[model samples]
Target: MRQKIIAAAIAAAAVVAAPQALASEELNFDAYRQMLADGNPAELFEMEGEELWTTARGPKNATLEKCDLGLGANVVVGAAAQMPRYFADTDKVQDLESRLMHCMDALQGIPSAEIINGSFLKGERAKVAALVAYVVGQSKGKPIQVDLAHPKMKEMYAMGEKTFYYRTGAMDFACSSCHSQDGKRIRATSLPNITTSKGAAEGWGSWPAYRVSNSQFWTMQHRLWDCFRQQRTAEPVFGSDVTIALSTFMAGKGNGHEAVWPGVKR
Candidate 1:
C-alpha cells in the first residue's frame, strides 16, 4: 500500500510539472523563430514582387507601376497599411485582394475573371501574391489605420461582427472558437485571441506574409480561405463580401498597431 501511495504521488507531481515543461518548450519555439528571422526567406519573395510590379506582362503590355492603390496612381509606398478601407469607385468596402483585382483589370488590362478565378499559389494568382508582398513591404512598421467611417464601412462592420460569432461548420466551429481563448496553440502555433486589440494587432498586422511551409506568399484573402478549409466549412469565394467584412473587423480591431505586412512566418 505504501508503494502504491508513492506511485500515485509521483504521478501527481508529474502532472503538476507538465505546464512548466510546456512553457519551456514554447520558449524554445521563440528561439527557433529568432533563428529564422536572421535570414527570412520572405526577402526572396520581396525581390520577385518588386520585379513583377515593374515588368509588364498582360495583353496590354503595361506594368502595374501605374496602378492606383487608393492614394493615387504610382503611389506604392505605405499603401498596404491603409487597405481594406472604403473605395469611392467601388462604393463599397473592398479588401486588398479585391482592390488589386480592380487595378489589375483596369490598369494592366488583365481579365478580372481570369485573375479572380485562378488558384492562389499558381500562375497569375501567384504573381498577385508577390505583388502584394512588395507593396506591403513598402509599409512595414506603419500604423494600421483602416478607416471604417463610411456608410458602407459601418454596414460591413455590423455584418462582420455578426459573422464572427456565426457558427455553421460541420464541427460548429467559428473563428472565435480557436481565437477567443488566450494561451491556446494548435500544432505548436500559438493562437492569438483576435477579439481584443493586442491579439487583433498581433494576428492581423502580420499578414500578406510569406509562409515557409508552402514556399509562397499569402495575402489576407488566401489566409482566410485556408482557415475555412481547416474549419471543415464551405470554401468562400475569393474576395467575397463575407471575407472582406471579416478583414474590416480584424483591421479595425488592429487600428493604431504597427504594420508588419509581408511578415515572415513558419
Candidate 2:
C-alpha cells in the first residue's frame, strides 16, 4: 500500500507538471481568422452586387433599385438589419436572400426559375452570392433586428424552432446536434452553440463571409443548405420554407447582435 501511494504521488506530480496533457483541446484560429478578415475577398463580390442592384437586366429590364425589402422601395441602407420579417406584399416571412429573389423577379422581371433550383456558386447563383454580400454588408455593425411581433413572423419562428431540433437523415443529425453544445469540434473546426444567444449571434452575424477553406463567399442560404448536406440530409431547396424557417430561427436568436459579415473563415 505504501508503494502504491508513492507511485500515485509521482503520477500526480507528472500530471501537474504537464497540465496541458489533461486540458481540453482548444484549437483557436483567431489570429489566422483575423488576418483573413482584415483583407476579406468578399469586397469584390459586394462591388459586383452593387452593380447588379443598380443595373437593368432580365426580360423587363428594370433596376432592382425599386425593390422593396420590407422597409420601403429603393431603401438599401440598414434594411438587412431587419430581415426575415413579414412582407405584406408577399404575405410571407422571408430572409435576405429570399427577399432579394422576390425583388429581382418583381422589379427586374427576372424569372423566378432563373434564380431557383440552380447549382450553387456558379453563374447566376454566383451573381446572387455577390449580391448577398453587398446587401448584408449594408447592415454591418448594426444589430440583428428580426421582428417577431407580426403573426406571420411569429409563425415562421415557431416553425423554425421545430425544424432546428427535428433530427433525421442517414446520420440522424439535427442543427442542434452540432450547435446545441459548446466547445465541441469536428476535426479543427469549432462548432458554435446556437442554442445560446451569444453563440447564435456570433454564428449568425459572421456569415456572408469569405471562406478561406473553399475560396468563396457563402450566403446564409448557402450556409444552411450546406449544413443539411453535411448532415447527410436531402439538399434543401434554396430559399425554401425550411431554409427560411431555419434562417428566421437563427436570426431571431441573434437579435441585438451587431452584424459583422464578410467574415473571414477557414
Candidate 3:
C-alpha cells in the first residue's frame, strides 16, 4: 500500500512538472532578439534594393531615381519615416510598398495587375519587398513621423481602429483578442497592446522584419495577411485600403519612436 501511494505521488509530480520544464526552455526573447540583431540577414535585401532602385527595368526601361516618395524625387534619406502619408499625385494615402507600386507604374510602366498577381513574396512581389526594405532602411534610427493631418490620413486611422477591434472568422478573434491586453503571448512570442501609444509604438516601430522561422523577410503587408490567415479570416489583398489603414494606424501609433526595422523576428 505504501509503495503504491509513493508511486502515485511521483507520477502526479512528473505530470505537473512537465509543462513548467517546457516553459522554462522557451528562452528569453530579449536575449535571443539581441543575439539575432547582431548579424541580421535583412541586410542582404537592402543591398538588392539599392541595385533595383537604379537598374533600368520594366517596359519603360527606366529606374526609380525619378520616382517621388512624398519627398522630392529620388530622395530616400529620412523619407520612410513619414510614410502612409497622402500623395497629391494619387490623392491617396500610400505606404512604402503602395508608393513603390505607384512609382513602378509612373516611371516603369509596370501594370498594377502585373505587380499584384503572384504568389506572395515572389517575382515582382519579392522585388517590392526588397524595395520596402531599402526604403525603410534609409529611415533607420529616425523617429517615425506619420502625418495624420490629411483628411485621408484621419479617415484611414479611424478605419484601422475599427478593424483592430472588429472580430470575425471561425475563431471570432480580433487583433485585440491577442494584443490589446498586457503581457499576452502565444508560445514564446509576446503580444503587445497595440492600441495604447507605448505598446503601439513598440509594436509598430519594429516590423518589415526578417523572420528566423521561414528564413524570409516579411513586409508590413505580409504581417497583416498572416494575421488575418491566423485568425481564420479573409486575407487582405495587397495594398488594399484595409491594409493601408491598419498600417497607417500602426505608423501613427509608431510616430516618435525611432524606426528599428529590417529587424529580426521569431
Best by lDDT: 3
lDDT of 2: 0.80
| TM-score (C-alpha) between model 3 and the true structure | 0.89
Best by TM-score: 3
The per-candidate count of clashes, in order, stands at 0, 0, 0
lDDT (10s digit) by residue, model 2, range 106-225? 877776677787877876677778788888878777898888999888988889889999999999998999889989988888898999888888888888787655566788888888
- lDDT (0-100) at residue 198 of candidate 2? 81
Better of 1 and 3 by lDDT: 3
Give the Å shift of residue 127 in candidate 1: 0.9
Q: lDDT per residue, candidate 3, 176-257, as tens digits? A: 8998987877876888789787788777777888766556789988888899999999778889998998889988987887
Clashing pairs in 2: none
* CA deviation > 4 Å runs, candidate 3: 1-26
Candidates in order, TM-scores: namely 0.86, 0.88, 0.89
| Candidate 1 pairs with clashing backbones | none
Q: In model 2, which regions exceed 4 Å deviation?
A: 1-26
Q: Is candidate 1 or candidate 2 better by TM-score?
A: 2
